[model samples]
Target: MSTERFVIIGNGPAANEAATTLRQRAPQSGITVFGKETTRSYKPHLLPDVVAGRLDAEKIFASPEDYYNERDIQLRLGQKVVQVDFNKYQVILEHREVVSFDGLIIATGGKPRIPEPLEVFEDVMMTLKTTEDARLWIDRLARVDSVLMIGGDLTSLSLTRALINIGKKVFFIIDAESFWPLPFNERLHQEIHARLREKGVDVSSSRKIKRLTQLSDCSIQVETDCADFEVGIVGAFFGLVPDVRFLARSGLDIDRGILVDENLQTRFRNVFAAGDCAQVYNPVIRDYWVSIGYDNARTLGRIAALNMLGGMIAAQASPESIFSLNGVQVNTSWWMEF
Candidate 1:
C-alpha cells in the first residue's frame, strides 16, 4: 500500500490551515502547498499594517520557511497554477510544471478586483492584497499627499486608515447611494460612516469614478459622476473574486466562487475547496458567499482536510448572522487616524 498525496493551492491562511490539518490526520500523506507569491504563508489581514509601515514584511508570515521543512511539507512558491487536468489528477503551472496529487484542495483565495475605470492607470493604481503589492506601492505612498480610494467596505476602510496613518490625506469614495455595502441596519451603517468622517476622512457617497488618467509624474486625475479630482494615487476595494480563471473551462461548479458542499468538497470527489476561493453555504444569506473571517477560513480548511481523508466533518464557521460590516468595521476602533 502507498501513502496518499495531498496538494493545496494558495499559501495563505486557508492553505496553511488545510495543510496543518492534513498533516495531523494523514501523517504519511505527501502534503504539498503551492503559492503564487514567493513569500511564505502570512495573514492577509496584516498587509494593511505593512502598508502603514507598522509591521515589517518578514514579520507578517504566520510561519517561517523552515517550519514547513521541519513538518515534512513541501512549499512550492513563485509558481502560478494555470490549468488543471482532472483526469490526470494534476495541476499544470504557468510554465508547464505538473504537480500530481491523490487528493486536491483549491485554496487559491481571491485576487483584487480592479475596476475597468482604473485599469488604464494600472501603473498609478494599487490593490493592497499581497506583501509584494504593499512593497511596490509603499515608496509611492510616502510621496503622496492625498490618496483616492473607491469602495465602502471593511478592506477599503482598513486601507484608508493605513494611508491616513502615514500622514497622507485619504479620499474614500462610496459609489453607491449609501456608504454601507452589506445589509446591516441603517443605524450601524450611518455610525460607521460618521466615524470615518469624524476621523477627517473625505468620505463621499453616490458618486462613481468612471475613469482614471495617469499624468506624467504618476499622479492620477479621476473623473467621477460628481466631478473630476486629481490625487497622488487611486485605489479600489471593489472586493475580491475567486482566482478561478484557470478553471473556467475545467467544468467545476462555480457561482460567484467555487461551489462546495457542507464538507467543502467540490463536484469532483477527489477535489475540494475552501476559504476565499470556496463559496460555502451561508445560512444567513441562504446562498453561498465567500467566508471572509479568520475563524471561517480555519474551520473550512479543517473540514476540507477531514473530508479529503474520508472523514465527514461539517463546516461550522460560516457566519449565521451579518453583525459586522464586511468584517472590517470592528477593527475601525482599534486604530486612530490623524
Candidate 2:
C-alpha cells in the first residue's frame, strides 16, 4: 500500500538525480518534477559550451531557479508527458492534465534524430540537440560564411570546435571512414583523425549525405556521392531517438528500451523507466541498449528511484557510457586565432 506521491517524469540528468535521491531517501516522499524542458536540467554536455561561447547562460544551469524551489521539488515546466495511465496510476499531460502517482518516474529524455526528408526552414540546415538546439546553432554561428558538418560523433568534434572558433568555414562529413566507431578504436580514430586534420577540420571520412536541398539564395544543398556542397550551415549528426511517444499506445514492454529488469521494474507495476529512455541491461555493452547520457541520466535516475522505493534495484546505468571527452578544434585557417 504505497502512498508516496513521488511522480517524476523527466527533467534530465536522470530526472534531476532521481528527484534528489527520492528527496533524500524518502523523507516523507513527494518529489514531483515533470519538466519537458523550459529549464533546469542543463548540462546537456553544456550545449557545446553554450555553443562555444564558452559556457555562459548561467553556466548551463543544473540548479538555480531556486534550485528546484529550495528542494521541495515540484518543477513541472513545459510539461508534455501525454499519457501513461497504467491501469490507473495516471500521468497524462500535454494540457489534459492527470498526474497522480505513487511512483511513476519515466525520466523521459531523448529526441534528436531529425531525418525524413529534412524538414524545411532553409537558410542552412542544423540540428545540435537542445539548449534550444544550441541556441539555434548560436544564431547560425553568427550568420555563417561556411560550415558543413554532418556527423563524426562527439557532436561532430564539438561542432568542429564551435565552427572553428567562430570564423565559420568548417566542412566535415562522415559515413565512417573513421572516428568514434563503437567507441573509438582504430587507434583512437587515427588520433582523432590526425588532430582534426591538424586543426583545420575538412575531414570527410567515407562520405554519405545523399540529399538536403535549400538553395534559392538561402544556401545549403548537400548531396554527396563524393561532393555537392553549398553551405552556410548543415550540421546534422543525426543520432538519438527515444521519446517513446508516450509509450506508443502503451502496452508497456517496448523492445529497444523501457524493458527494465533487475528491479527497475516496468512490465507495468508501479511503473518506472529511467533517463535516456530506459533500455536497461547494458553491462558494458552486453546488450539491451538505449543511453543518452548525463551520467546515464543520473544512473537511471537512481535505479528508477530504488525500484520506486520497494528497494529491489540494480540498474547502475549502461550502454555506451561516456564520461568525459574534453574539447577544442579549429581550422578554416585558424578562424579567429583562438
Candidate 3:
C-alpha cells in the first residue's frame, strides 16, 4: 500500500503546528510543507525587535532545518502554492508543478493591507509583515530620520515605539478602518492617542489620508485631511487581510476568508484550513468569524491536523484578550506585548 501523503500550505505558526501534529500521528505518512517565504518559520510578533536592532534576524526562526529533516518532513521554502484542485486532490504550484495529496491544510495566513488611497504608492510604502519586510526597514532606517505611519494598528503602535527608541521621529495617523477584527471605539481611540503622545510620538488629529506624493529625495509627502507632513519614510499599517487570492475559482467557499466548519475542515473532508486565512463557523452565533493571534492559530492548526487523521475535534472559540502597553488597553495577541 502507498503511504498517505499530506500537504500544508503556509510556513507560519499554524502551518508549523499542523505539520508537527501530522508527523506525530501518522508517522509513516509523507508530509510536505510549502511556504512562500524563503526563510524558516519565525515569530512575526518579534518583527519590532528586528527593526529596533534588539534581535538578530538569524535568531528569529522558530524551527531550524534539522527539525524538519529529523522528522522526515519535506519543507519547501520560497515555493508558492498558486491553486488547489479539490476535485482531483492536487496542489498546483506557481511554476505549474502539481503534487497529489491525501490530506491538505491551508494556513496561508494574512498579508498587510494597503489602503485604497495609498495603493498607487505601494512600491514606496513600508510594512512589517514578514522577515524580509523587517530587514528592509532595518536597512532603510539608517537613512531615515522620521517615519510617517498612515494607520495605527497594533503593529503600527509597536513599530512606533521601536522607532522612537531608536531616536527616529514617528508621525502616526489614526485610521479607524485599519483596526479590523478589533472593535474600535472613540474612547479607545482617545486612549491610544494619549498613550502615543506620552511616548513622544507625534499623533495626528486627522484620521483620513487624502494624498501621498513621493518626493525626489526618496521621502514621502503625506497630506491628511487636516494636516500635511514630509517624512523620510511612509509605513502603512492598515492591518491584514486573508492571503487566499490564489484560491479563487478553486471551488472552495470563500467569504472574507476560506469558510470552514467547526472541525476546521472545508466542505471537502480531506481539505482543511486554519490560521488567519480561515473564517471558521460559530454554531452559537450562526455565523462565521476569523480568529486572529498566535495562540488561536496554533490551536486551530493542531485541531485541523487531528481531524484530518480521522479524529473529530471541534475547535473552540478563542476569547478576545487585550494587551496592556503602559496602562493603555490594546486588543491584540499576547505576543504583541513589547
Question: Whose lDDT is higher: candidate 2's or candidate 3's?
Answer: 3
Clashes of each: 0, 2, 0
Write down the lDDT of every candidate, Cα atoms only: 0.76, 0.68, 0.84
Per-residue lDDT value at 128 in model 1: 77
Off by over 4 Å in 2: 1-12, 29-41, 49-51, 72-151, 169-201, 204-279, 282-290, 294-299, 306-308, 311-338
Model 2 RMSD, rounded to 1 decimal: 17.0
Cα deviation in Å at residue 104, candidate 2?
A: 19
The C-alpha RMSD in Å for every predicted model, in order, reads 3.9, 17.0, 3.8
Any runs in candidate 1 off by more than 4 Å, and if so which?
A: 116-123, 177-181, 184-189, 282-286, 317-319, 322-338
| Model 2, span 179-266: residue lDDT tens | 3213445675676667777888777577666677777444777788887878877876655556887787777887645777655677
Arrange candidates by lDDT, descending. 3, 1, 2
Scanning candidate 2 in windows of ten residues, the lowest lDDT window is: 328-337
1 against 3, candidate with superior TM-score: 3
10 residues in a row with least lDDT, candidate 3: 323-332
Global lDDT of model 3: 0.84
Model 3, residue 48: C-alpha shift (Å): 0.7
lDDT of 1 by residue, 1-338 (tens): 02798889888878898999888878888998888899898887888889889998888888876989988899989988899888888999999989888899998877877656556656667777888888867877767788888765557778777877888888887654223325445675577668779889888766776777877454788888889989987876776667888898887888767888767888887799988788776554455555665556667778888888888776654343432444431111112232
Candidate order by decreasing TM-score = 3, 1, 2
